[model samples]
Target: MYSVVVEANVQYEKESFTIVGLPVVPIKKSKECILSYQHTLGIDITMKKITIHLSPADASPPSQPN
Candidate 1:
């Protein structure tokens, strides 16, 4: 199994969160994960903007044989 490193940056900017250097699917899901975790911990991040980046941006998951 291969491991990937993800970097997260939190900024005090307009309410927006983004995941860079990743495909559309994971980017979309990232928000869900963040929101879910924050909700579980009762942490309010409504006013903050969060950004996440995946290292080795070109890296991709191995393909599966059908």
Candidate 2:
């Protein structure tokens, strides 16, 4: 089993999106998902600096021997 902690910080001064603490592939995908979800609700995140962090980043799912 694995655990991940997600945190988001939004700032109105600049337009930037960043993810920290983890290097998972899906983290990139999360940007797309957030964009789509925001679009659905008519929210503009373009002028905001968004920061996402994943804690316990070293944790990974348990693997089973084949």
lDDT tens digits by residue: candidate 1, 1-66: 335567888878788777776678876776687678879999766777888776453577557999
Supply the global lDDT for candidate 1. 0.73
Q: Residue 32: error of model 1 in Å?
A: 1.3
Q: State how far residue 64 of model 1 sits from its true place (Å).
A: 32
Q: TM-score each candidate.
A: 0.61, 0.60
Candidate 2 regions with alpha-carbon error over 4 angstroms: 1-5, 55-66
The candidate scoring highest on lDDT is: 2
Q: Cα lDDT of all candidates, in order?
A: 0.73, 0.77
lDDT of each residue in 1-66, candidate 2, tens digit only: 567677899999779988776566867776777678879999888789989876574676447999
Deviation from native of the Cα of residue 55 in model 1, angstroms = 4.0
Predicted structure 2: lDDT: 0.77
